[model samples]
Target: MILYIAKRLSAGIVLAVLVTFLTFLLLSTSFQDVVRTILGPSATPETVRGMMAAKGWDRPVVVQYLDWLSHAVRGDFGVSVYTSLPVGPSVLQHLAVTLSIIIPALVLTGIIATLLGVWAASRGGAADRFAQGISLVGYLVPGLLLAIGLVVIFAVQLKWLPATGFTPLTEDPSAWLRSITIPVIVLMIGGIANMAAQVRGRMIDELRQDYVRTLRTRGISTRAIVFKHALRNAGSPALTVFSLEFIQMFGAALIIENVFALPGYGSYAFNASLQGDIPVILGITAFGVLLVVVVNLLTDLVNGWLNPKARVR
Candidate 1:
């Protein structure tokens, strides 16, 4: 098991490096004059040329990438050309803002969806139908639309939560919740719907197996049979999708953060892409690659732990 984990982690690291390379390649291919963008409309041609030379932006793409990568290895991601701040600290603050919402959305969505799915699957009638409806709605609706609708309902009309902006947790935890609640809900919808549907289907299938019948025949309680035995088997299959929800949450966060006016990594990335801020963009991409790789590695470990059969491989 330890060797399997070690191999997966090593592979994840390699994949992260590949992802960074691809992201850098794509960004470098853009036509935008990043130096001009930084200096703005008033900058003279000589200034732009000198700036590019000074920053080594005129260098070959591979050379520039290696320069940036070498500095990144030393914990210097370069000063943001636009923000005039160290990319590392800027990225961390933005990343923390993102995580504040994404982590809760992932955990809450998983727990709530799993419980509801178990209930719906066990009941297997109207409950099942309701779960299906949630899946359809979540799957069909775009996250932006969902976020807009939620903002309108909860913020504009109901006035239950703040409509936009964010506050740091250290300053005011309550204010932070008030701000993040809506975005988290927007993120939760897809997660809950997808996870619930997966759980429902897996449990239903598990319940139908002969072993489940035999367990029931041996006079086990319905709860014990469904939850203890069938649930374990059912849950193993769902971990793959559960792991996928991490990525899903990140994607959803991109839309939700913008709509909600949160200055998170998603919003930063969005603005950076528009401005051709390669340093910020590359920083975020590198972090995202590492995050995704880590999530997958953790998922593999969890799935293996849950299913003994998976551990042998």
Candidate 2:
């Protein structure tokens, strides 16, 4: 297990490096000028050129990429063009906000979906059909639309929570929790539905296996067989779906963040792209790539541990 984990981690590091390099190359080659965007229309050409030179944009693309990479290795992510604050600190603050919502949402979604899936699989009638329908709605609905509908129902009309904006936990923990409730629910809706569907499918397949039938024939209680034997085997595929969903939640929460006006890395990335803030955009992209790689590696390790054949290989 340790060896498998180490191998997966090594592969993830390599993939992250490659992703960062490609993202840098693409952003650097784009026609947009970070300096011009930062300086705005009133700035003279000399000013813009000076700003470019100061940012070392005048250097070759490879040189700039190397410099940025080196700085990243040393924990320096440069300054944000919009705020002139060190990009590392800025992004970290936003990342924390994102995680505050994402982590809880992931946990809640996983637990709720797993239970729903298992229960539906065990029943196999109208309840199962209803669960399937719920999953379909979750999978088909656009995240932005869901977020808007949630806000309208819970925040605007019902006045149960804040419509948007994030409050720091340090400032007021209660208010912070209150503020994030809707966003977390909005974010988890699709994830829970998708996870439940995957779990239900896997559970059904596991129940059909010969081993399950053998257990049943041996006079084992249905609950015991399903919970102990069936669930353990069914978990492997569910873990795979969970890992993919986690990565998607991390990177694709941009639309939800926008809808909730939450200050997160997703919103920063979106704004950076619009402003053509090359450094900030590249920094966020690098972090996102690293996150994805790490999640994939973790998933691989978990899957390997759950399946002996994977560990043996």
Candidate 3:
């Protein structure tokens, strides 16, 4: 198990380096545009050259990436070109806001989707159709439209929740919950649909296996056969989908945050991209790559727990 974990960690490290390097390379290609945005298009060629030289923009991309990586290892992500503020702290703060909603959404999605999927698979007929219908509706609706409609009904018409803005959980837990509720729901809808469908399909497959018939003949309770043996076998694939849902949620956050006016990682990253804020963008990119690595590692661990044979692979 230790060896397996070490192998996974090493692979994650390599993946992080490759992802960040590629992102950095792509961003570096836009250096000229970034400089123009920073210095303004009206600036003279001499002034632009001076600014580029001052910022070490003329350096080779490899050298620049190495320098950034060294500082990143030391927890120094540099300052934002647009805001002139430290990138690490700002990125972390906004990320915290984003995670506040996303974490809850993900947990809820897993639990609810699993229950729905298992129920649907075990009790096919109306129950299966119901689950399929819900999943289909969630897939058909656009997240942005769903978010807007929710805000209109719950926040605007009924006044049951805040329409925009966020409150720190530490400052006001009730308000914080209210602030994140709609956004969480929006994210959850899409995630649950996709995850539940995958789980349902896997469960159905597991239930049809010859072992299921043997278990029934051997006097194992139907519930035990389904939930204990079948669910465990189905879990490995379900978990893979669940892990990917985290990344999907992160992408959806950009739209959800903008719609709800939450100060979150998505909005921060979006603004940074628009202004070509290299330091901030790179900081967030590194953070995102690190997050993906960690999530994948966790998923592998969970998969190993579900199926010991997976560890060797």
Best by TM-score: 3
Cα lDDT over the full model 1: 0.85
Candidate 3 residues 1-313, lDDT tens each?
8998999999989988898889889988888878888787798888888888998888999999999999998999999987799999999999999999999999999999999999999999999999999999989998999999999999999999999999999999999999999999999999999999999999999999999999999999999999899999999999999999999998888998999999999999999988889999999988998898899999999999999999989
Ranking by lDDT: 3, 1, 2
- As for candidate 1, its clashing pairs are none
Candidate 2 lDDT, tens digit per residue, 54-104? 777778878888888899988898987777888888888888889898888
Error of 3 at 283 (Å): 0.5
Tell me the deviation in Å of residue 211 in model 1: 2.0
lDDT of 1 at 206: 89
Q: Which runs in model 3 stand beyond 4 Å of their true positions?
A: none
Candidate 1 lDDT, tens digit per residue, 1-313? 8888989988997887788888877876663478777788898999987987887777888888888889887888887777778888898899999999999999998898898889888997898888888888878987788788888898899999999999999999999999999888888888888899999989888889999889888999999998788888888768888889989788767777878889998998898888787788888888888889888888888888879788776
Of 1 and 3, the candidate ranking higher by lDDT: 3
Assess each prediction's global lDDT (C-alpha) against the native.
0.85, 0.84, 0.94
Q: Largest lDDT belongs to which candidate?
A: 3
- Candidate 1's C-alpha runs over 4 A off are 30-32, 39-49
Count of steric clashes across candidates, in order: 0, 0, 0
